[model samples]
Each structure stands twice: as structure tokens, then as C-alpha cells.
Target: MKLFFILFFLLVLSVVPAYSYLDPGAGSMLAQLIMGGVAGLVVLFKLYWGKFKSLFVKTDSTTPEKDNSSQTE
Candidate 1:
């Protein structure tokens, strides 16, 4: 672990910046990718909203209660 950290520090300290140009098209593509991923997640959440909501919600009994008030003596 120590040797790994030493090597990582040396690499980071010796790293040189590459003169790169980020074109507008590449930036727009990256933005679209981020937005699409977010929109996809939103749609998935909307589709399974009921199931996701049920995870934290409590349910009452499914059986109906008997009404004794209508019983004859």
C-alpha cells in the first residue's frame, strides 16, 4: 500500500498537461449524453413509481371484517 501510494504521488507530480482543444461538438455531445441519462432515469422512476412507493408504505389487512351489528339474536 505504501509503495502504491508513493508511485501514485510520483506519477501525479510528474504528469504533464496535454495541449488539447475541446470542440463545441464534443461538448454538446457530452451534455446530451448527461441529459439523456437523466431523462431515462426519470422515465424509469415514473414507470415503477407505484412499486417504488410501496416499498416504504404499510399495507392494511386484505380480508374484510365481519359485521356483527346485522346479526339476529
Candidate 2:
């Protein structure tokens, strides 16, 4: 594993940098993709917010009530 990582590191370091131009349309598309992801996450959370809250809240009535009368006695 160490040898593999060393080889991989050397391989990555040997790569030449590429000079590329990013057009305005590419930037706009990237921004739209990020915003779309954020919007989708917000909508998803809104839809599941109630279910998420229910995970921590105990609403079931099946459990028996604790005996509090003995405490008073």
C-alpha cells in the first residue's frame, strides 16, 4: 500500500498543467448547477422535515404510564 501510494503520488506530480480557457457560458452553467443542487436540497428538506422531527419525538401511546402514586406516599 505504501509503495502504491508513492507511485501514485509520483504519477500525479509528473503531469503537465494544461492551459485552458473557460467561456462565460461555462461559468453560468456551473453556477446554475450549484444553485439547482441547493434548491433541490431545500425542497427535499422541506418535504421530509416533519418525518425528521418525528424521529426524535415519542408520540406513541402503547407504553404503560409510570407509577407516580408511590412517590407521593
Candidate 3:
């Protein structure tokens, strides 16, 4: 992780400028990529975090829920 940060920082600090022209579509794509990755990680964290917490904490949700189980018209 430390090495990855160092490499990223070096790349960000490079004196050479990029000569390539990035169109708006490419910029939007990059934005979506970053946002999608972050969203995916958040979802994964929520899923695993729930399981992790369940290891030590007990919830009543494990029992059969009856909110919509009975319908009498």
C-alpha cells in the first residue's frame, strides 16, 4: 500500500505534461470508473461488515418476520 501511494504520488508530481487531448467523453468515462469503483467497494464493505458484526452481535431479524405474512380480506 505504501509503495502504491509512492508510485501514485510520483506520477502525479511528474514535471512532464501530458500532450494528449482528453475529450469530454473520456473525462466522463474516467469519472464514472472512479465513482463505480468506490460504489462497489462501499457495497462490499456493507455486505461484509454486516456479516462481521453478526459474528459477535445477535439480531432479532434472524427470526421469521411476520409483517406481511398474514393477509385476511
Model 3: how far residue 24 lies from native, Å: 36
The candidate with the higher TM-score, 2 or 3, is 3
Q: Tell me the lDDT of candidate 1.
A: 0.48
Worst 10 residues of 1 by lDDT: 64-73
| Residue 34 error, candidate 3, Å | 11
Model 2 ranges off by over 4 Å: 1-20, 38-73
True-structure lDDT of candidate 2: 0.50
Alpha-carbon deviation at 26 in model 3, angstroms: 30
Summarize candidate 2's per-residue lDDT along 1-73 as a digit string, tens digits: 6545634664575464543233336546644543567564455445357556867998763343335433433
> How accurate locally is residue 16 in candidate 3, as Cα lDDT from 0 to 100?
49
lDDT of 3: 0.52
Mark the regions of model 1 whose C-alpha exceeds 4 Å error after superposition: 1-20, 38-73
For model 3, what is the error of residue 46's alpha carbon versus the real structure, in angstroms, after optimal superposition? 1.6
Tell me the tens digit of each residue's lDDT in model 3 across 22-51.
333754664454456766445545645777
Best by TM-score: 3
Measured over all alpha carbons after superposition, the RMSD of each candidate to the real structure, in angstroms, is 24.6, 24.2, 17.8
**By summed lDDT, which 10 consecutive residues of candidate 3 come out lowest?**
64-73
Ranking of all predicted structures according to lDDT, beginning with the best and ending with the worst: 3, 2, 1
| TM-scores for the candidates | 0.23, 0.23, 0.35
